[model samples]
Target: MSNSARSLPDVAYVAQPGLSGRLDWVGMDDIQAPVMLVGEDDQPMRFPARVGAFVDLARPDQRGIHMSRLYLHVDQALSTQAVKPALLRTLLDGFLASHRDLSSRALLRIRFDYLVRRRALVSDNAGWKSYPVVLTAKLEGGRFDLELGLEVLYSSTCPASAALARQLIQQRFRADFSTQDLLAREQVAEWLGSEQGICATPHSQRSSAEVKVRLREDVESLPFVDLIDCIESALQTPVQTAVKREDEQAFAGLNGGNLMFCEDAARRMQSALDRDARITDFWLRASHFESLHPHNAVAVASKGVPGGYLGGSTV
Candidate 1:
């Protein structure tokens, strides 16, 4: 009826029962949406993701931000065409456009599971493994920081346990058979091959490679696959996808050869990260879910510049 032309105010308005002195930043957090996008595997994937966003409401006396508009902007973008990095940027950019007078910055986050088809070690038969990927972006002063994070599952074995098993088997064989009557080495080796207890370690389960990268501001390329591969290769002990008997044997051999404790796995990943020139900084955590113990064993490492270690002083 009036000149405004808009039917009604869309923002979530809460009538303050009692007024406060001031409120700085008040917005929405954990709003969920199913967004369509090309996954890291380069195929169309839809994500039912939760978003956490915040916006600043200006004026020294203002109470809160427009929470409804923020949620609506994210929902609209999520419901649009297949999401790419560029499209996500559009969503963050649009938040500012929708509320021009409210704030200078808008933060957006989307968490989704990325399904990757992996082949079996013995079967070449394909199956899906889900990796959690998070897409995050921030817009302020016409600059955007885009970050993509992914987690890769791998495996490892314990070297100390393997060594102990070998020694124990040899000792048992020697004790059971006389020194003059039987040679322990050949008998122990055969027993080790046959015995289930000595064949593998106590704690051999899946390990994960977690990687996050800040996309180059000028370039549009997000090397998601390459980043994942680099992480897997760094670990050097990924569980096999497709396998024949030979593949299974090879996988077993890899697990045996790369016998590692949690600390060893962490060090290996760290060394690999330090060797790779593509990453700016990296942090790695290697965990071994214990079969014998109730608690898990873990090790962590981070990549830091060697300014002071190379004779320069620390900040």
Candidate 2:
């Protein structure tokens, strides 16, 4: 095995002696790879996107780290508008093919800011903002795991608690059946200010919608946007990304009528996800940054993972 006859790296980058330490994988995170990822833009978002990649490198006995090859695989897949679970699965398959002797387990993480324009409630003014997002993809034993997460900003209107207070306040008063057997919400609002009502509507700002689903075998598509729409609609007081006065008026009316507590928000979201047929399994978390309290309020529900979905147990 003379020098010319020996194997050499097919890539240009060189790994320094013992530079990778004992870690099985290491590489750039902010390394931007242009992608037209599915479920993102209705049109292709072909700008540079950042991804965190890891390739298995065994003992120091190995000759080279296939870093460039790994990047190339990512680039190639991303070149087409074909980035999703299947694409990632193929990339991992390619990675394993390139490093046959190394371990088969591979991990890929994509972290990027997703921006959408929202309409302001009353002004209908357009505002552009970004949401922090992360996608975790892993391949092992010929199967792949994909997770997509979105943190959404919203406001929760405390309806249940308000109703409770209205009930408590009106229980002892000179209430009559002529009262229409129904107390107008406006009446409840006035009674609280006039009497010993412990009622208050607290708005929780900056809520998050976090969902992860298993893509089923026969399913043709993943309704990521539709799910996002359902989740946002369930929030009732979803903050606007683009708004006109009409949108604002609609939103304000929504706040007035669809008051919800943190618990209510969680249940509403759970119901929305449950109605979605595309998702095989789901996990939901709602983090509400409270305006009235020092600490945030949070509620969580998952299908089959919690006791059951919608804050229930035993399915």
Q: Pick the candidate with the highest TM-score.
A: 1
lDDT of each: 0.67, 0.65
Tens digits of per-residue lDDT, candidate 2, 74-176, equal 7778777556666777777887787677555777877766666655666636787676666667777776766666676776666655576557555644443
User: What is the lDDT, from 0 to 100, of the residue 293 in candidate 2?
Assistant: 75
Q: What is the lDDT of candidate 1?
A: 0.67
Q: Across residues 1-315, which tens digit of lDDT does each residue of candidate 1 receive?
A: 475736676333434424554344456767878877676556677768777776656543444566777888877777877766677678877788876766777778778776566666556576776778777677888887777777877777777777877777666655655556755587556765676425434357777666555555554555556666677777767766656787778778778778878788777777776675555555556777766677878776666545212221211
Each candidate's clash count: 10, 17
lDDT of 2 at 121: 62
Q: How far is candidate 1 from the true structure (C-alpha RMSD, Å)?
A: 5.0
Q: What local lDDT does model 1 show for residue 275?
A: 72
